[model samples]
Target chain A: MQLAVLILEDERPVREALARDLGHFGGHVRIEVAEDVPDAWAVIDELDRDGDRLALVLADHRLPGTSGVDFLVLLLDDPRTVHTRKVLVTGQADQQDTIRAVNDAGLDRYIPKPWNPDELRSVVRDQLTDHVIEHRLDPLPHLQALDAARVMPLLRTRGDR
Target chain B: MPTDVHHPRSTLPRPTHLQLAGLVVGLIAFLVPLLVDIPGLEPAGQRMLAIFLLAIVLWVTEAVPLVATAMLVILLEVLMISDQALVALPEDVLAASDYFAALADPVIVLFLGGFLIADGAAKFDLDRNLAAVMLRPFAGNARRSVLGLMLITAMLSMFVSNTATTATMFAVVIPILAVLPAGPARTGLALAIPVAANVGGIGTPVGSPPNAIALGALEARGEGVSFLGWMLLAVPLMVVVLLFAWWLLTRRYIAPDTPMALDLSSSFDRSPAAIVFYVVAGATVLLWLTEPLHGISSSTVGFVPVVALLATQVMGGDDIKALQWPVLWLVAGGIALGAGIGATGLDTWLLGLVAWEALPLTLLVLLLVAVGLGLSTVISNSATANLLVPLSLSLATGLPIDATAIGVIVALACALAMALPISTPPNAVAYATGEVDTRAMATNGLLVGGFGAVLLATVLPRVWDRLGLL
Candidate 1:
């Protein structure tokens, strides 16, 4: 099954611009949108009922009141989510936290703040591919259930892109 | 040897009589010449040898209270050896008796003011607040965290005596130490505070004794240095030491470890308190720098009265009453000791031993500076200056040397030497950090000692010649 992408950011100009940028890839790469963690949580709540697997989560490090790292830590704790690539997008990431989350939460990569649109697509594509191929390539459907929510941005796509 | 291997640590037996005899012989090497009226021993030669050996002994045993060991040298006049003895004036020999002159000194008053300001900062938790706010936001990784600590400490040392600065930071740093995931981050902060404190102290005259002595001596001669002049020399060196050593060392040795600390962010989040801190710090810098403009010293710019008012204004009288009086008194006592040495002509007599036209002028000045800076490691900076400045003045006794330049160098050397803890307040505070071993501090000073001597040797002779001091 082809997976989807989710972009959650507070700024309208930024969120819409990213959504518009991602539309170029077409519907085969299903792109979702949310303004913040709460809105994103709501989207996850709905997805929980349907069992749609999220291919990648590109998150802003600084959201309304929550940190991207903290948010990722929370997402990783949930058993329902599996094999989601988390990308922290921020100008002000705790570099140390980014490294730690890569180890603890399976953080696949990050899209840094004021990100390049073309670059974001490539990183998301590469991270999702790497995540799926590394863990899901073995063909055990149960193995596709691991979460990348805690992975740090530093560990994310470069050559994979 | 086998029996010793099994001995318990605290219960190790006392030294035998033969060992005690060796220690007694070591003491006699420093003592007998000063006390006994030995014929033809030439008291100057005896005392010089005695002083040199005393330096080694102090560096070795360290059990003898350092100042007391310093004061014991006065027995040169007290026991009154034959023709070899150093002649003492009728008034006093012990030098501590000259407290009145030192208590009246403006530099001592300035130290009084500086300490008062530091004490007030502590009482009101200004240092604590500053540390909290600054340290709070840092990523506790090796490189970034070490940089944060160095920046915080280097700035603090600019105002407070490096010693007081270290103590102030140590209070905040110790609690957070446990929080850091162990590695270079912790080690860097530990090493940075003291070195930063000592290095940072070079910025402001009030921050260290050596600078004060340098300034006070120059001021006394009516050719004092301006604030800008001092900053040009001190600030650059301080920045160089802090950046080159603190950050680079951590990067090389401790990088990659992510150390964490008590999120000091929440406590100093208040803006007003932090503003007050900056205001006081700004005022101190302003006041110290403008001393050259004002006819009076910033120290005497109502050192006590201004602090009293500020304390009452900022922290209240109850806080003001709790100021560190012992330190103030000890400082005052140190000044008294300087005056005492001066009054006895011991300072001049010390000059007598070195005075000779046979030696070339530049070499002599450099030699004198080396001697002054060297003495300060064992003796306090103020006393070193007091002993040497008067001696510098005496060197001009019909000689072509510039008394002002000689005095200025002596004062500068006294402050900048920074060899051992006893020499400068910063060294003492660095020693007190508990993080630094005494041996390590002394060894580190060997580097500063070499740097300072080279600087003085190179820059001073030209400055002296230009100023017509040589």
Candidate 2:
């Protein structure tokens, strides 16, 4: 099954830059971009129709109408995307919003604006690795996108099985 | 690798303190009219008052989506103001559908035309070309660049959405700001666009929603201001305020010795679509200005650009689809509320409560202008105009002062209330750039707003007298 990494940012420049920065994993994963919550749901529906998994979601908290936290809270209810790794990649979300995101959405990470590219890549890699391992999916095919050191044991153990 | 992050489903939507407070206020507003008898108010007027109070509170608190509140206003009008209740409207006064007909008011059509023109301009890069041409004279000077940016932004906002004008100018000025040293000049450059945009929108009826609301209110009262008449009064005020804003922004933030090299010529788009837009937009403006000769109302004239742009294929279906519907709904809601107030005779009752004869006309004008400016700084300017224009007109009926003049002054003052980021979309857009914060915006806005109010009070009366409106 194809793995999807969704970038939900309303701003086109920020969305394009985020997608471009994660281009290395595009070969093995579906790198989808959505401008808002409704667009994100359409992408999720398309992935579900194709029997693909939404492995991660990097969202901005301040969107046009429905906020990123509200969308994250929504994902918890969907059976298809309940396990998706959620990250808040914005500088605008206040403490209350961040707390709600963590408490309600099971947020995996918080990356403030003007982020380090290395840190962003590492976060994506680690999240993907965790998703693969938790679901007991074979990590060998998507090794390029994962933390190899952490997934190596899983691959080795599954190889013997 | 397997970080066990437990994802729990919370189906219950959490209501914040503000939302809960809004609900409480909304409930009280809805129930009060039914429970208690307001003095000098008919049953229908009392019911209309309840809906008005509820809508105002809900709009201010943002209890729900703004469009939702607008829809609710229409729904409540149908339910409570029906022929049976006769709470706001007399029996057989209006058909059920007539209550919602405010959505299709001619003034709303004017705004739709404005949006289409703006969208077509943006789609064809016509705005950039126009800005570049306009700024050419002011190039090479640091202070003039600030003035030029403000001038271009303000002028564009006079015919387009203030937010769109600010966004377009923000993109154009960013590169210029980047080249400047990281200091007050950069902040000044960032802050000037929004300030000018806010001031500039006072130039015409279609410049902002508040202007349209004022125009719509005036038209409903059978005392409409002509397109040329409005421009004659407002454009000069806009120019004066814009110049003051430019001075205030530059003197406070920009250094005199700051070097500048603005190259806007390269940003111009000389495409066929742009050419078509220019011809159509120019013709529409000319027609609007010479309305007395043509005998066509300005709102009727607005349809020309809408048809011309579509016929020329300058604006596509997607552009039409992307029109700011919520803003239109918001304006429609204001119009509907104004109609409801008029029908219910709530305007008369409210006027009776205010002692217009007790205060001098000049003091009353200043007080009304101050109230409009103050309320707008805290809420949406459109909302401020919606709340104030109708009341000011009603209040004018009791006094010797002219209602049309009061409407004009109140509308202009609404546009001038830029004391905070939440005051207007343009201010919020500038604040989002991070180059200028709320503190910087408020400081500059207070000074500009103060100057604008004084200028209006001193100059508007003379202009009104000249136009034979006083």
Candidate 3:
């Protein structure tokens, strides 16, 4: 099945560059772009209703509107968007505090910018393989209504639920 | 996960209007001294009350112009005493010289030079560049991150205003702290920047208010402190305190050193405007020394640095428009208070009341320091200096020590009051940042203040004496 992806980023250049790269995903990857949290939320809900496979989120941390982490904080809170494998994209590599948020939110990966294009492509390829394998496993008999359940372990933090 | 709100909910209802908050703050600013000055409470308690009033006013009411509120301190000064001036100048009207004196204070020139340097540095985006390179080496480790921030803040504050320094460094480090692997480094940064901001501000007269007041008092007494001489004192004091602050704040460790990816260009990395800063500083130092370079008296030499700064901007085309007018006014108001203390013979009267013949000069310096530190706890540093500097000048003139050199210590001591949250803006700013607690700052601040006091009373005086200041 064809997969659709949402790119939530504040910078025009970064969003556009990521969209162009996603065209190489080959199974007719449909790309939607949202500049900030509100628009991204609207897009996420629309995609969920359409039953489009929202395979990934490529988000930049220092967005012009809502902060990337704050957006993720709200995104993970919603059951609809929880199925989407989230990845944090940042230009500021010195931010070590993102790891905890990434762990708490069940983030798949962090792409530090001034990115090596080859490295981004390889990571994207790896993520796409994992999505394909999981969906293929659920193509038949034995699957719970377990959309976000597999990723829940990453999001389950100690001390509080 | 629930998003956290920073302020804890309390039963006390929020004040209905900004005006109410302003009026309450204003009234407290007025009433505080009398309430605390009465008896049982220490002067530290009294100063804390004034700072609490100012801090609440600053935090609570956005409507009140801080400058206007700061000017209201004149009302406090007016009420702090009722001794009639033998010849009172009309209220709301200044004698011509009182107004002009603001123009000639070397503190203004020093501030002008600092602004030009920092402005020029900003043009180069020095803070951003420094953050980019500095944080890269500390990438994942929390402790190294805190250290990186302290060093950058201290260096930048020597040129920029301390408020600007804290704001700039925080902007840079917050991003770094957010991306760091979850650990204590983030918390340490939240605490360190505020304190470092306070300590770093001590590096220059223009960085904080008390330095400006102290510098003004020194210049007024004809023992104008030199730029080089001021640095000689500020460098050791600031650098030492910053390290102690780092130790006090964080116990985390660094990961191995990572190679830095420097995207910076070396071409004019240090702004050419530094040439202007150096020229202004050089002339100030020359005048402070050799003592007779200008055609008039060394007393008039404070103007030399001011002239040099103006000439450099005009002839050299450096922008000098960033001078903070309110700060100049505040300094002038402070200088006026110090001068009035001298002019009123209050300094002489206060000095005579003390048994000067009974104590040695070194002991006298120690006592004056104790009073300066104590006075600063209840009043603003500028107010503390205004109260004590003139008295020190009067006492020194009659005694065998350099009164002007002691005045420099008085200035440094005013800035050095690390014991309270409200004593200096840096301390207050750091406390407000929500990272460092008051106890951490107080414990470290006292150690910092003690070492600073010793440096001034012992080391600075001996050196100034050797330099013929005594």
Candidate 4:
């Protein structure tokens, strides 16, 4: 099964940019974009139907309704995305919202607006690697998108049959 | 915070087309021998033949997991041809416990010790630390660095499982791999780990499952090779094949002038617990090598570590629980299959079908080696050894060759089948790095395996004889 990365954003230009920057990972992972909370849930449902894991959620803090912090908090209650890595990719999240995201939503990383494309990709890679290692998933299928050196310990346990 | 929706889905794997086909084909193969009367085979022999045929299909297609197929072989023998057979055997029947005993065979115990020690090495970070320390001397140039990497990998593989060795070595080299320009040099470095690991597996009985399978079968037939004896018989070939592969890979892919630097930083675990583990692991190896010096069997010496590690709390129940039981069971299944073949007169029936003595010994040996090397190239190496070692040993009974030589040769041949990513776990790991493609792996693997095959089939036996090892 492929690992799914959901991009929760409201702006068309930003959504497209995020998806394009992650284009290389498309072949290795399932990348989905949503305009709001409802659309994001639809993406989760589609992923669930296809038996793909919701591995990471890159969400903008400011959305039309049910803000990204709220959505991140909701993920903890949903068994499907409970283990999903949460990231706030926004410039507008204040101290209060960011605090809640860290304490309650279990945010993994915060990528500020005007982020470097290389750093964005590296953060995604690191987050994805963390997800796989935490879940003890077989990293061979997603080795290209992963930090290869980080997954070697898992590989060592698979003895010769 | 709001409570969210819970969608708990069950994801059970569906059988592939090959598995579906295997089940159907295996049923037909299993029944044919039981229903159709052979010209000279006995009723019990036919029953054993049915199990063997089913095992071949299931193992090849992997209709079930490899360990499942192994466990199935043991259960089938108990219910079909053992003393508790569903249809009472008209001839002498092996006791059911005889089949079950494969799980705890002396060879299995030996592997159990080896595995615990290997696991402990990883737990204490001893493997990576040791590699770092050993690789310091060979770090100047690309060629020398690769030689150091390969030699260290092979040395670890001689004691650790081959797959584990490759993984450990890859963990050490991946940073270095990233620094080197991604091209033939990267491919060469990636390929070196598996080649060394696969060849090194032949160095010791506990190094790989196929070795345990061969040793188990040979031990049952009253022709057991001491641990040191096994080293003497196989290590020379292991060293030769490794050097040949190093030369081939360097000449073809690695340029001597390429920029390379190996990371040698390491911090070994010096905890009291780590000290206890080192002592136990070291004493175990010393005991295995000095088997001739002392009267204790390798398996008995193997058990000492299992007891000492636990008694001293160096390794506990959790450590034992983490041991590779599936591999142990798979080897056991092969032992049971081998035992059934001999006990039910199936070997006699098989020997009569082939005029093996008529073929020149060298030609026959080459054929056996070729078949072992070829079959295992696609299937699991342990399964290939499981199916071939017993039959070849039985065939040797009627020929003018040492059974030990035949058994050891077949096992080593199985180790040499690494021409594809699917051939062995170590190869699969190298391929997953995406640094080495199939063509490079196949070309290098073929040259290495072929070179090893020729030496194993033609030269190793004579070497054994000349050294009075056989």
Best by the DockQ measure: 4
Give the best candidate by TM-score. 4
When 2 and 4 are scored with DockQ, the better candidate is 4
Candidate 2 lDDT, B1-470, residue by residue in tens: 23455553334445679989999989998889879988778877888888989988887777886768777887787788755444545544445576678899889888888777777777777777789888889887789888888888888988877877876787677677768888788788878988898888888888888888888888888999888888888898899888988888788888767898776675655678877888898888898889989899888888888888888888778877878788888888878888888887878988888677898778888888899899899888877777788888888888887778888999999889988878887676566555687888888899999898987876677777887753
DockQ value of candidate 1: 0.01
Ordered from best to worst DockQ, the candidate numbers read 4, 2, 3, 1
Clashing residue pairs for model 1: A82-A145, A83-A146, A102-A152, A105-A150, A106-A151, A107-A151, A109-A156, B95-B340, B163-B429, B210-B415
**Per-prediction DockQ:** 0.01, 0.03, 0.03, 0.65
Question: Ten-residue segment with the worst summed lDDT in candidate 1 chain A?
Answer: A152-161
Worst 10 residues of 2 chain A by lDDT: A152-161
Error of 2 at B314 (Å): 3.0
**What residue runs in model 1 are displaced by over 4 Å at the alpha carbon?**
A1-161, B1-99, B132-141, B175-185, B213-233, B256-284, B292-294, B302-349, B355-445, B459-470
Candidate scoring better on lDDT of 2 and 3: 2
Greater-DockQ candidate between 3 and 4: 4
Which residue segments of model 3 deviate by more than 4 Å?
A1-161, B1-95, B98-100, B130-148, B181-183, B247-322, B360-363, B374-379, B419-421, B458-460, B463-470
Q: Say which prediction, candidate 1 or candidate 2, comes out ahead on DockQ.
A: 2
User: lDDT per model, in order?
Assistant: 0.56, 0.81, 0.58, 0.93
Model 3 chain A TM-score equals 0.73
For each candidate, give its TM-score against the true structure: 0.52, 0.74, 0.53, 0.97
Better of 1 and 2 by lDDT: 2
